[model samples]
Target: MIPIYFCHRELLGLLFKSQIVLTDPSEPPLKTVHKFMQKQLTSNVSKPLSSDVIIKSNTGIFFVETTEKLEPSPLAVCAVESASQTYPDRTIYFFMKGLTKNMTITKSSFYKAIPLLSSMENVNILPLDLEEVVQDTPLYPWYQKVNPAKEQYWKHVSSDGFRLAVIWKYGGIYMDTDIVSLKPVQEINFLAVQDYQIVNSAILGFQKHHQFLWDCMEDFVKNYRGGIWGHQGPGLVTRMIERHCGMTVFKGTEDIICRDFSILNTQRFYPVPYQTWERYFQVWNPKDSFNNSYALHLWNFMNKNNKRVIIGSNSVVENLFMKRCPRTYELIIKHASRK
Candidate 1:
């Protein structure tokens, strides 16, 4: 039996004293009571109170920013806020590599958004210590030997490595900051398909200590390429998928089970391909329902012109913000109105 430590003696007494009548004859009384206690404990401690009062059942949704930028982009903040709203029961963790423990919030508009992001009960804004995250993983040796200054694409390479390390360390979903969450993901272990032949690492879900993630980490270290763009990101995942499940094209939205893990169809995350990312910025006539899609990847990397989402534009992106992330939308409108 897993030992549960209680800080308050009164709370412990109240637990045992509470009437927990089990209707199912098949289930052991003790087991039923234990589950009830666990549920009670989880609901009571929604926010991080103490180390002992941890929410083990609540799945983790992680978003990492490898660059030393304390103030996250508006889209990144929207992604986090949307996820938090979608998964109120689950914990949404936003790790900023540049955020320090003692850092103060400045008066800048960007910095002010941090407090609003943190205001959500389920959202946790934490510091990302790369070295510490990769310590026990297979990527540790590679990370130690790698010189970020020498690497041409260190930002992309480091972000790729950090995403893998964090997911491996704590079993949950890892998504790029650019991607916004639309709904709760049901798959416990799966990878998002970017296209017919490639799988994108923008979003991934797996249990803690999964072999596929470990293999990916090992492959990441073995094939360690800092100079080649997408070599460590999508390229690494695509190669790993081919090795695990062999080359196969998904025809529909149905999930293809690749041994222990599953490969989700492109429509689930990438309904709008990167090639047509402009569709997000353009106004849709009929508007897309995207019933099958769990989330939308704005392809922020592909926005060369760096078009901002206008409140009255009625673009797909603006509508998404208004409906999916109201807090962020309000912030945008508030900032725009001030100017």
Candidate 2:
């Protein structure tokens, strides 16, 4: 859930550079909207904020910033956007925007302030910068020794090409060249990062709703010097993650390749592993496609066609991605006509 005041353009400015999180509804940080969130929480819920907003739930999209006190005020909430005000179906809430600034209050204060919106366990206000919201994210320390550089340029290039192709054709998250289908999904309106093994910091979830995905992207672009873990794009994020002392404590079961990224059931493209499907995982043998494994990475590529990666069904690969991307197909036909 997002706080109301953070939406104000100027206050919101305070947020982009500040850290935030997607909290479980159970441990909500604020009890009531600070006079800041109260006065600032605009009725103006705009079009789904940038997927970059990050924290997500089945209900709605928002970016939250919390304060300690709930100084009272009665500022009428402003409309977020024209589209939002016009749509009756969308119920985007901007809670607690009328409270005072920088005051330290607790979840209990919020109930006294609003006297509405039933509270739950995670009902306390969430802190935008959780200097103490610590968690243990895990990883394999073996990668610490590798020198970061442009090793597999062609494969990376090809993957980029494929990514753009899918984005131009398919309208959701592009599966990394390595990912395979896991389970059948209904329909996802937003683009989510693709990975069952690791966070694709590469493949992104794009939805008008999520601004956090883009936030991660922007943060990577700004900070990444192409470190060993984050070679170019995703590596930047992972590298930052690598620096944190708390990272090693969480679940390290996921690989860095493709983790938690959802596999859409649109049947857009049926991708296989970089090797024979049967020979995908080296250390582990996964059973389910989407759950256990959705991709097989052909990591550590060199200029060696002699070192063959049995992409099992080459003809099948050709047949699978046979249809021209609609936009590209139209362009090609138009270009040919001109020629």
Candidate 3:
């Protein structure tokens, strides 16, 4: 007899199979597998939130400052531009520790071609001046250790620390530069999950002085792993959720409520998996693509070098670029055509 709490028919079947082990101990460890499956469904039953304002005061949309010179990439431009358009009422902040030299143009045609981002009235580009923003926070020590290097390790580390510090001080939502907002987000405190197990820190929200974020920053210092790429990013987020929420498996669903925070389904932000990152650039099913998603994570950090948003391409990314950051799109096509 399966427990009534296991209402999902599929889960009920799995639990029923696990009972076989009690009769025949030689059988597979179906009970362990059932527990694993249950944990994996953590997000499956998530209650989707509506587009209603939850927190009245700390309502801001934020993006990490990019070191690329000239303008940000079309995707980066779209990330901020779309957010501004989607949530006109919310203040947007673009924070960076420092600017890149030649912060005007990159040798590459597709990268850093959008100049319109600098002029958005709602978007404030602020320097991550440690003394002013993070000097007294728990994350300041990690910030001090963030010396720039030729390797990409420091960028991730600094970003992890900077985002935590800023949000802790001033509550708001923080998005990666690659994410394109498709609609206004309503949840005031939430985290996005990318897979069945890992919670991505790419898109995060919280009120000022959220304890979960402080815990995450403390974990970052205690378990700082500069060599491990995701140690401070997704890895730290996942571990923090476990430590604070007592969660083991994330089903990448929308209804997961831990204390006052919510866990968003991967479909909400990352409809396309990383393994199939090209789908964002390919128009497979226009009607079905991102139908219910509020934003799209183009995985630009992983695909920026190879992917180019052609002017007239009917791909999903090109479409998003044309619609969300039309000015930048026009500039890129115009320049590329002239050459």
Pick the TM-score winner. 1
Candidate 3: count of backbone clashes, pairs at least 3 residues apart or interchain = 7
lDDT of 1 at 130: 75
- Residue 194 lDDT (model 1): 90
Please report how far candidate 3 places residue 144 from its true position, in Å: 2.8
TM-score-better candidate, 1 vs 2: 1
Q: How does candidate 2 score on lDDT?
A: 0.28
Error of 3 at 5 (Å): 60
> For candidate 3, what's the RMSD?
22.0
Stretches > 4 Å off in candidate 2? 1-171, 182-198, 227-229, 239-278, 281-291, 298-339
TM-score, candidate 2, is 0.29
- Each candidate's TM vs. the true structure? 0.82, 0.29, 0.75
Off by over 4 Å in 1: 1-58, 106-110
Sort every candidate by lDDT, greatest first.
1, 3, 2
lDDT of 3: 0.65
Evaluated with lDDT, which candidate comes out highest?
1
